[model samples]
Target chain A: MPPADHSYLTKKVISIGIVSELTGLSERQIRYYEERKLIFPDRTGKGTRKYSFTDVETLVHIANQMEEGVQTTELRRELKRQKSQEEVKRNMLRGQINAQFHKRH
Target chain B: MPPADHSYLTKKVISIGIVSELTGLSERQIRYYEERKLIFPDRTGKGTRKYSFTDVETLVHIANQMEEGVQTTELRRELKRQKSQEEVKRNMLRGQINAQFHKRH
Candidate 1:
């Protein structure tokens, strides 16, 4: 099983302003990407966007990809594929753990 | 002077349905692109979108760019740049024509 400390699955904790600076992309660009359903950021009670380390990484990656002329649709598909692959891995680990428990009994 | 028959600047005339099929993109995606101001199609009195050959080419170009990981913001910037360039060319042509008229007189 992957460590619980895996950064990508962690919750949002960084502000959008900081995210913009970190990603070196304009805030408008970030918001537009969100509007396009490219990236999902957590919102505060007051409707502020909170990002995570993973989100930062993802944004940077997206920026690089865009510079390379990649399209958003393909990026979205790649992200979905990564998420499903992670889910599969998690399920496989759980099945292995369950099998070990049954053997001990 | 360049021919005025440039396809890029032509008025919209193709239906959204035909544009979708020709571009191999879903109708929703084409609409979403419009919503994002990525592509503009002319509307009919019945609120139908009509695209021109340029719009079709732009959509296909966008799809290719997205596949290459390009962001919409970048694409928007590119489109804007192209427009300004054409505007500059038009102004230059008009200036040259005025100069010729004055010299002939």
Candidate 2:
């Protein structure tokens, strides 16, 4: 099978109310997280916020982190760190795979 | 380089005071997080809590989340969800690699 279609996770199609219901966070709280730069939702011409599946997950994750007593700035830094670490790991894996593939040929 | 020796991340050798300083959380806050089941620190015979590098990271993550207004219970659930999701993704990637390797042979 082909790789899973993860586009839906990034497609900004869900509304803030739905995201709130799905994430168990109030709409106001979700907006606050956005204000804190923890999540970025898309905005329509009418200026309404639209979220994606990934955004919901992020909101949930952020909420979970906040519940643990993490400050927003620290959380932002941690998120950035994790993202970079994942990128590095992905690059290293890609290099290894390319090396192995070339060796077989 | 032999997988970069990530064992230090899991080795329980750091003290609570150090962890507090490293994560920018108070010793009492870290203990509170532990009480809320957000972190698990090893204990010495004298009842001192010894943390790993991973634990320090976790404490920082938890604190960051708490700062974003996530409740402890929600954070726990989100952490569990992320762990399982990562496991699933790893398994899928491993399976794909195995399949590709076998096909080449």
Candidate 3:
């Protein structure tokens, strides 16, 4: 299967209000999460915050964990761990593809 | 190792002032957590709160979670889950002990 588009992960397509509705989190809570460095939504030229799909997904995950009494610092650590694991998998896949190409040549 | 004694877990031995100092939670926060039903400290006949070590530990845990932006309801659920798991383990252990005694007989 083709890899998912990275653009969709980053494209700021949702407003904060929509993000609140989708994530079941208050706008103030979203802003508080940003202040805690749990998420980073993009900013408009006028300084309004716009959220990407990634941001919305993160807020949802955070909400669930927060409900579980998980600490923000722990959540941040988990996020970093997940990102690192994904990077490692991506790198391993790239290396395998390169090796297969060389073998064919 | 023998199973840890449960008496120490429930024995109310500390004042709220000491709990506040030890747990690093304000007196008001401790009361609020009680109001939230997160911890149930014992009360004197005159109705002053007295904390067990377990209550102190739970407060510390709750404080950490609250810092992480965890919701109270979620924490309550987690607390209930932990209690249920402990009860299940205790029941299993009791069943094992009873089975061993019956086998010996």
Candidate 4:
């Protein structure tokens, strides 16, 4: 991938204020989420926190989950679970594709 | 996202050999795809190319498209188009969510 394509969603271009406006979360709440390691934002040269579009989406998702009474710890665990599940699924698919390719050869 | 979680799909863990095995593409073919910028792999400290599972999947997808007579240039364009469309969709969703939140406030 080109540098631009690679950074498409991960680029830290949006400021915290913009992210707060986008997600409807206060700067404090956003920082709280970062403290919990729920969203990872990049620091600018002056140490300003800058977020990506992915981070904004995650913040919105986190807020929605919190509004539904889910605990931060539980949400963290759930995210880990989901990520691992995806990893497993991808591995299985890779295995299947490899198997089919070998059989065909 | 936690550091580990953020690097889950982006980490360069699998060697090129493993990636070739998983994707059923020869090392040469995999390198060819890389030449086309269809996938990006990271270099190890020893200068060995290391791929993530995401890169493996992308290689498989690219191989399938090639088998279907898709040109690399065309595939690149399609990927760019898809990414931009996804960006637009995400922005629209964010806007809707923001509007809803403000309305509720």
Candidate 5:
């Protein structure tokens, strides 16, 4: 089994202002994405939103893709679909690997 | 630079039934994609939709990606985005390559 990596989970969160600065996405756009459930940033005790470096990176990629003539609606679906597809593929592969190990025993 | 390949455009056209058989996507679904302007097939004299080999391949790819957990909306956007992105990238590259060739003269 591959070693678990949760380093991203521990990354610091940035205020909405900082996130917008880093991603070049407007605060309104960020909030809209959150409302659409495109991203789920961390929350502070005072109920402020915080974004990680990965989130910023994802936003950048998303923005770049949008600029490449991809419709925003379609892009959202593609991102969601790719994520789910990989999860299914991974599970199936892991199951096959486990089955092979079991047969070897 | 890659040579232009328009061979797929000349491939045979299949009726809705054949497309469903080849792609495992329902005739309704195939027709629906066309309605959504996702895939544009040819038209018979009787106004029936005629799908080429490339159209069939595209439908299959779209279906497979949908099965992979991508939202249809996002997938469509992604596909469109990727296509346009590549076109832009190609043009940029071609321009640069042409600039270099001109400098040689």
Candidate 6:
């Protein structure tokens, strides 16, 4: 599928039902998970949940981790750690680009 | 502290109390965590809980994750994924070392 924006490619946003199918979990279960605040899916104007490729990836990670008997506390920490790493990467890349732009100017 | 058998380094084992101190979790909580199969720490002959640096790190992850509302099931799945990644790394390294050994022979 084409991306929502012109920048990133291949990965695209999907409906909650599609997410449930990809994650091998029931729609009710997915909604339940969101209510518990495990994941925050985007909402439509009609209040329907919208899933993204990123959300599906996260669900895959959660499913794999649970199979190994990891507890919620540890999982949350790891997710946060991953997010921080992503942020750090973005910041480093941005810094490099900014440096290049200034150098060019 | 010194290494257990000296394969890898920097990390060392310690008592459950030490684990508690390092992870900021109570002894009862730590024991509870183990009983739930969240972490598998070593056991002394007297059945005392012996935690390693790795176990403490896992506890820290659990604590942080729980505070963020991650469910137990999801946490378990994530842990399994991480374990698989580690195992893959080990296998790849082993394969490389074996290749080098065969080349020498």
Which structure among the candidates has the greatest lDDT?
3
lDDT of 4 at A83: 90
lDDT of 6 by residue, A13-33 (tens): 345655665689778766765
Q: Taking the tens digit of each residue's C-alpha lDDT, what string does model 3 give over B1-105?
A: 554644545555456765776678899999998998999876766787867666777898999999999988999999899999999999999999999999999
- lDDT, each prediction: 0.78, 0.79, 0.80, 0.79, 0.73, 0.67
**Model 3, C-alpha of A78: deviation from truth (Å):** 57
lDDT of 1 at A56: 75
| Model 1, span A1-105: residue lDDT tens | 444743323445456655676689999989988886788887766787867666777899999998999998888889889999989998999999999999999
Superposed Cα deviation of residue B39, candidate 6 (Å)? 1.7
Worst 10 residues of 4 chain B by lDDT: B1-10
For B30-62, candidate 4 gives per-residue lDDT tens digits of: 888789877878775678786765677788889
Q: Candidate 5: where are CA atoms >4 Å away?
A: A1-5, A8-12, B1-105
Interface RMSD of 2: 17.9
Q: A31-82 in candidate 3: lDDT tens per residue?
A: 9988888998767667778676678778999999999999989988887899
Among these predicted structures, which one has the highest DockQ?
A: 4
* Poorly placed runs, candidate 2 (over 4 Å): A1-6, B1-105
**Candidate 4 — which pairs collide?**
A38-B1, A39-B1, A40-B1
* Backbone steric clashes in candidate 2, count: 16
DockQ of each model vs. true complex? 0.01, 0.01, 0.01, 0.02, 0.01, 0.01
Counting clashing residue pairs in each candidate, in order, gives 11, 16, 2, 3, 9, 17
Q: At residue A103, what lDDT does model 1 achieve? A: 98
Docking class of 5: incorrect
TM-score of 6: 0.41
Q: Please give, for residues A1-105, the per-residue lDDT of candidate 4 as tens digits.
A: 234645536655556765776688999999998888788887756787867667778889999999999988988898899999988998999999999999999
Query: Can you give the lDDT of residue A82 in candidate 6?
Result: 84
Segments in model 6 whose C-alpha atoms lie over 4 Å from true places: A1-105, B1-4, B7-13
TM-score of 3: 0.45
